[model samples]
Target: MIEKIEDIKRIELSQFKFPVNVYLIDDLLIDTGFPRTAKKLLSYLKNKKINKIVNTHGHMDHTGGNSLLQGYFRCRIYHYPAKRSYTVVEKLLFGNLKNFTSETPPEKINTDNYSFEILYTPGHSDDHITLFEKKKRYIFSGDLVLHGEAREVSRDVKIYRAIESLKKLRTLRPEKIFPGHGEIFYGYEVLDEKIGYLEDLGERILRLYEGGKSVKEIVKIVFGGERFPYFFIKGYFSCENLVRSYIKDPKSL
Candidate 1:
């Protein structure tokens, strides 16, 4: 059991323990999994009827199955209007580096079966979006919100945007949050946790900056301990970038 939520179907694929949830409702398939898992997904939907496939964002993991799924089902793909250019960049990067090419430019969603209100939450990525169902009070938060461990917003622009988006989401008072990379959260506590984590990190970075510590020095002091993974060195550098960016605009902290 990969922790299935109401009104959503869960499918575990490969080594990724966090299974992808496909929201099935009246012929709509929201957010397909990575390309490597397409075969299993196709098998799952073989006899089932589907109308359209919509993505909460344009991350490769989210839209990697697009081309393959379209080849079989020939269904229309829908996503937020903001992800178009990012989708193109993703296609270009994957196209040049990988043998498989499964990228499809999605269309803007405008339907009646399910009404969606979009929140431009750009922290995990510049083009991130969360979809809210007004009637159900359910949010398909791609990466803006997560259930476990805080996410890094590498860029200052994205961090500011994420804060704005989170503030906007606070108004919704959503009952449940279906995130892209984790288990669904039951209440608004998850939102507060995310905010608190970011705020703490921001404050620490600001204090280190005020103490005249170089980014590398701060990285060693703050996260160079054994608690942090060795592989996260690059991520630490990204966080340094965030720190530098925040230095330029202290309001972000």
Candidate 2:
């Protein structure tokens, strides 16, 4: 379904366990939901003009429909340029990226009414970015801001970097957030909650590490035990990955 917010239109493509959202502003489309849901996305924008595409990140859920949309609209796509390759498991989960090559977007994106500052907010992933319209204080926070606490993270997630990105967003004090997943939320309370949780978690992990507690012991003590879904994801998202993040980048603590 499509919901209008001012001049922007939000297309909610997936409503599963992890919901996916894509936004449209003027001729620009921010983040494609998934390759499987590309048809629905196309249907919503059938009567609209989408000349440009900008992705918040390269994750499958976010960029799955890139190839299809670009081919259909013959539009240019933009993303933060990175030099990393995906793992076999990552490809299996996030889907193939096809031959889509995105140029680097400018510091600001100017549409008919609003001009968005492309903030390089990399926490969820190194190539992650968030679009901000300073005048309206609106943020298109990809995976950087979610509704719930991020207890488990994937292998590529740098918790310290995520914390820093959250802090950066907090400084903006955005009035409303158009997230990559979930609903359009108001205020910075969710950002605060995530920052506080990560900071506290980092401190605790640092303390446990200083006390010679192994990652295994830390995960057990902090999270109690591995819950469902972690085993199924091949340990891609786990408390242990969160614990190791501090070890990898302890200076942040």
Candidate 3:
């Protein structure tokens, strides 16, 4: 279903195992929907007169439809510089992010009604960036504030960097935040909630470690032994991933 948030339009979907929320701002499309939702994505853009695409990050679910949409509209796909080489990215399972040949995007982009400033907000991914509209204080925050908790994540995500990223966003005072997934709404409160969740996770991990609980035991105690709900990506995101972040820096608490 499509949701109207103030002046922004949101295309929300759930069949892809992970929730998908793609935003449309005039001719600027923010984060293409997943592969499974490409057809619906095209239909949505059919009458909307899309001219450009701005990917929040290089994550598969976020960038999968870039090629499809680009093929349809002959539009340009813009994102941060690829950390991995093109050949290296091609070898990966989903190299769709390499489809972009956009030069380094400008610091600020001017549209018919608003100007967007690209802010590099890493943590979810090294190349992650957010689009901020200064006049109205709106933030197209990628995956930074997915939910009220940073409970599940990829194993390699850094503990301190994620926290710092959210803290940095707080300083911007973004009145509205349009994330890559879930609903679009206000910002500061969610940042506070997710940051607090991460802090609590660290403290609990410290206490559990002192009580002589192993990593696996700590996972069970914290997340009830639950892996991800999907089978194929079962272990990719789980309580163990967050625990690993905590174990990497118990002193961070």
Candidate 4:
């Protein structure tokens, strides 16, 4: 079932535990959830008149429902023109390969509604973009700013970019945030928190590197104490990427 939060509605789909938020403005649907959850989403949309569809970004979990939604609504899908190819490859790699297939490049998305501006905040991925809706004072931040425990598991270049992106977002002064993977936050405080976390991690890794620590050693030190083994690999990967980023440019911290 989809829970309505003010003007936005969200549906938690499947056991994948994917949280797909569907923002609505009367007849317009801002985003569609994962493709594997298309049937349920379609059923929910059957009663509404959906004329426009846009994605926050092009990750598989976010764009997975695009093809089926396009077939059902027969409407143009809008996404950042600059990020289309990257989004496509990302979906192909992580989406349910057997069930969801790719589509042609997405057409350019341009709108006159000055209510929101697309901020190119690449960190999580080079194609990442954040939608700042001034009217609502909310930002539809796609994986660039995560709530709860923050993770920095991307290419070193991307991690640096992500930090830069977060800095850019801090300037927006958004009152709230709707992220891709977690609960909505009340204010920009979360952004500051994430930035601090990344900065601190970067500094720690730099210190370890100065002490002749390898990525493997640092990963163990940073995350070996965590109780959940599930996070070991991801934490290690993130540390490795940070280490690489630090090596490339010590000033990134």
Report the number of the highest-lDDT candidate: 2
Cα lDDT tens digits for candidate 4, 179-217 = 776667888988889889888877887898889988778
Query: Which clashing pairs does model 1 show?
Result: none
By TM-score, who's the top model here?
Answer: 2
Q: How many backbone overlaps does candidate 1 show?
A: 0
lDDT by residue for model 2 (125-196), tens? 889999999999999999998877666777768888888898999999999999998889899887888888
Tens digit per residue, CA lDDT, model 3, 1-253:
8888766789886553667888888788888866666777888788767777888887766776777788888887788863323333222433344354554457876667778999888877677888989999898988887855666677446676777888888888889888888887675787777778888878998799889999889888887875566643445556677777777753553
Q: All models: lDDT?
A: 0.62, 0.83, 0.75, 0.65
Those runs of model 1 whose alpha carbons end farther than 4 Å from true positions after fitting are 1-4, 14-21, 82-113, 151-157, 225-253
Worst 10 residues of 3 by lDDT: 82-91
For model 1 the TM-score comes to: 0.76
Between the candidate structures 1 and 2, which one is better when assessed by lDDT?
A: 2
TM-score of model 3 vs. true structure: 0.86
Q: Over 4 Å off in model 4, which ranges? A: 82-93, 96-114, 152-157, 225-239, 242-246, 250-253
